[model samples]
Target: MIIPFWSRLRLAPRIVLVIIGALLAMKAVDKAMPLVIRPPEAMFFDRDWLLATLQDIRDRSITAPAAERPALLRDLPVRQWLDITLLSSPPDFRHSEREGGFTDLHRRITDRLGLTPQDVLLKADEPDDPEYSPRPLVIILPPLPTVIMDVFDDRSANMLSSDLRIAFRIGPQEDWLVVTPKSDGQEIVRMTRNVALPLLAVVLIGLLSVWVARGIVKPLDDLAEAAEKLGRDREPRLVGSFNAPELQAIGNSFNAMQLRLKRFVDDRLQMIAAISHDLRTPLTRLRLFAEYLPDPDQRRQVMSDIAEMEAMMSATLTFASTQLKDEPRSPSDLAAMLISLCDTAADAGCMVAYEGPDHARLVYRPVAMRRAFANLIDNGCKFGSHVWVRLRETPDAFVITVSDDGPGIPPDQFENAFRPFVRLESSRNRDTGGTGLGLTIAQDIILTHDGDIMLSAAPDTNGLVVTVTLPRQG
Candidate 1:
């Protein structure tokens, strides 16, 4: 049954059906409410008329002879809506002055009848009669359920148990009146229709809205996550299948784009590697020829040139071969790694100090990350006397800062320093014996790992500070 019900309707039709069904159910309840519930007697009869009638009956009963008083009260020719009755002396009624008492109704009736509050007596419950049946009085009104108690208050009708009977004063004859009004079932029906059902409907609609919204939004969120992963890695896993047609189409497009990009990058890297490899043979032959030169001074100059060429070629080949994404990521102690690097530099007589947590674990390509940090540390050791390394962890990323107390590069030359084969003549000269590809290679590796490398002047002194920021694992 559930399968057929769901199979028949698409998304749009299902939404429409839910809305129409709710409206129709509310309308049906509104129509049937009147038939199921009846209005109170107070609604049909005016208060003034009811009060005057009660007063007239009481006055006539007071003046009538003691023997005729009972008949006079019973046959008062009152409205069909009202039931009049009289009770004998020692009516055995129990009086309760508490909640659900007709205090407000009694006051209004007394004022309307031109009587003070003290003149009227109001009591709840029934007379405490010994001979009275143990069974409670029950009133029946077809279609609508009837309540034996007063509609406006909790007072039960005494007339339901006995016919007209009255108590009379011996010398100055007088009589007191008692009245009971039925409750209007319409109020309950109105509350259920206007308030209760609508509130329930609102809650149900909200739940349905959330369910539908998640169905549409979850796929888009997954697609966005896949795109981010692709940016960080060359061989990113492709997004899987989706239920929605539009989302499935988007996923297929993203997979195709990733495949094409990977192929293009692979071809370029292969071509560069082949070219660099072929050039090495000629470079070796050139070095052999330079060694055989007759003039010693000329031969030294040729050797120096050949060595520079060879250094450039080696740096280029190294940069091309070490693809950052190719390295697999694994859990490692990042703080320990930084400390070890600093220790190695210190052993080599470079004044380097490490300061940070003793053990900070993270998933990363250790070899590539080590190489990147090594380049930065090497540059600092060559240009400055002292190097300080600091590692700090943030909520979403890890930061490693390497600051050196060397002659800092000019602010304008910062961008140029990261370009391959570019060096700052003022601070970093050819005499430093660098291929000028260190920062460039480091930046490339950091970018491939979805991290960033930033260079700035040391805050305390004149030197360069390199800060690397890498995303933290979840």
Candidate 2:
């Protein structure tokens, strides 16, 4: 199931998925690093150091005698963070225990001092109170000072203005530890930087992946377009060079294949043209010899047979010659051309009618297209009394249908009728079919113009319809 799913994805999307997977894997490694190995001091704050410093401050303040405790607290030589003053009367400020790491902090301080949890009280600063304003101060000691200051700048400082303040008594000494807690904002900034840097790296990696994928996929796209052109035209251009080694090899292979196909087709057409040219001399000599026969009926019979042979050879030569010829393209009124062909046929006593716009212009080989249409229209007249010619234009091509009211060929023999010299028995009577090359010639000319011709039964009639599709101008 996984294999099938993966196989369904296109190259570019698969490349993108691989890039995202790599980034996520890198992020997992990044998250796991602090647990597996210690990071540099700049990456995080040292919580152990903060806990030890708090404990040491408490020990020093408590060991001092009650009489000189206030002076000792003021001169404690600690980092300039807390306002360590002893109250003359019992403390007026009520301290309430708050949630989070501070609860554990309170417990740790009490356990180290060999006192109960009740002996220490931790409280958070209330910003809404008019009387109390918490000042932003740095407590983390040097070398680390610069790191913390850089991470927690003025914007973070403003957010951390309401700092946590803990007020607690040691025994009955009336001395309280008034200290600010660690900056939650600074920790938040450090964590965000950790996550954001990797995310930015992943974004850059994604962009690089897209660039590489496009480079790889572009050659394949060009190859597909070239294949389509090759189908429509014998002379399609070679694909451009590609950066990838595999794509370059494929392009070389495609160019070789095109050359082989073109050579094969040209060789076959040339051989047919040569064969038809060689047969004409013997055919002409036969006609001349038949004119000199003694019996008049025999002479007439031989001449008629020779004339039919000559007609067949002439048609084959013409079809081969047309296939080898290159016609220049020019803009012409397609409707007018069809109308003129129908009018000429009508003038010649064929019941043919044209139905389309007055002047729809398109780029095409004038002589080749006119000959192809003439062949189809003439075939329609030969097989059936009334012929209807209709022309319609689409955005990409022009569709022309020539329908006849004669008995249509069987569906099974529809394809066979387009083969050179292949005449169905139903239409093989000399009065109706000539040399069996009419449809073949029309198909050949249409194909040379990057178009197609198909034979089908006419809609709502028992007759044949020849549908010709020709490309429009650029």
Candidate 3:
């Protein structure tokens, strides 16, 4: 059956769950398989050697002299710490005395031989060095997978069940193997993990998860954020590149959409400019004809209309074109720019002041950025008595604030004021005349430079303060 892609994908194996299960299984088996063992037979002792020792002891003690009994034990070799501590009563009591004494003697052989607990009695090839005497080999391998055994003391007997671990060297590798008592319980099984397979599974699955996350979620998150910014009237951002061909195509599509949006906006702005320009030519011809009117007041009124039309046409061009379209990017001194702007404004009889350090260099388009600054200062001069232009450096960005001290716009109109031809009623009058493209042009220029233009109510005044923040370019 040809199932839909989504349904087929949903029915595919649960990769994460499968990986986790396989890791656990492999870890369990890795530790468990090494201990595939059956319990040693009860009282596991060498059959031939043990029987011979028993027989030899029985023969020596049978009607033997007291002095010869000790010599008989010395002639034969036997290990210490071996004995039949518990024995059922024998069918015949004669074997009881003979066998019982022999068993007891074997247990006390170390004391009889005048050897320390480290000395091995049964070992055939003892070293010539006094300290190198062979010790009894203790094979205490546990039936379970794991055990905790410690070897802490020097004088110790290994051929017993109580002490089970010893520290030793094998070539270059050094490790301690803890072999426990014959009484292996559930504790050993619980401590051990089937670690080998789980280790392989975990490493492989971890790498796969990282690749999936990077290829899918990370790129998607970036695209989502860019889309959100575009929707919020912010500049369209680029998704750059992606490893997935599907995502690369998606990114290219978004770029195309952004290009179309920019073109649409540009066409709208150009239409407004064209209409304003067409209206101004006729208005200029009308003013020339009005000059011949007999009434002075009527003639002046016609000329004022022509002047207003010309200002509107010029502002529309400035706003539509956003200053010189190609302002060469250059390394500019921000402090110097502010000082120069302040000096020019002051020369033009504007009460403007500049404050900051002497040198702050940043790479920017000098002419376009200067026009933005001029617009802001001109607004301050038009509305307020005192204009303060401050340039300062912050850790993340450079800030320029142009503040005025006059009646400011209402808090609600702060954003609306930046739109083209959207002037305040007070600013619209012939006395404080403006086309209202000053703030709009400034904002567009700032945006083109990847900077921001913000307007806020100036403290201690009824005036608006404009702030421009630009990211530092290296």
- On lDDT, who's better, 1 or 3? 1
* Residue range 1-474, candidate 2, lDDT tens digits: 254575455555767777787778677766765574333222232445655666777777767777776777667665354455455444556655555444555676677666667656656443442112223333222223344454335332222224455556665655566665433244444445556657877777777677767777788899988886776465666998766556778899998998899788778878987887898899889988988899999999898888887777777776867443387888888899999999999999999988889998988888878888998998899889999999898889899999999888888999899888787978645655388888887877787777888989988788999998888843
lDDT, ranked from best to worst: 2, 1, 3
Q: Local distance difference test, per candidate? A: 0.68, 0.70, 0.60
Q: Which digits, one per residue and each the tens of the lDDT, describe model 3 over residues 261-368?
A: 867887898898789778877887797899898999988988887787787788788777644546667889878887898899999999999888888888888887
Model 3 residue pairs with clashes? 27-194, 27-195, 28-194, 408-462
Write model 1 residue lDDT over 409-451, tens digit each, in one string.
Answer: 8888888989887878866878877889899888877877788
RMSD of 2: 13.1
Maximum-TM-score candidate: 1
TM-score of model number 2: 0.57
For each candidate, give its TM-score against the true structure: 0.60, 0.57, 0.57
Residue pairs in candidate 2 whose N, alpha carbon or C atoms collide under 3 angstroms:
none
The runs of at least 3 residues in candidate 3 whose Cα sits more than 4 Å from the true structure, single-residue gaps closed, are 1-206, 221-253, 290-299, 322-325, 425-431
Better of 2 and 3 by lDDT: 2
Question: What local lDDT does model 3 show for residue 136?
Answer: 25
**Candidate 3, overall lDDT?**
0.60
- For model 2, the stretches where C-alpha displacement exceeds 4 angstroms are 1-213, 292-304, 322-325, 424-432
Better-scoring candidate (TM-score), 1 or 3: 1
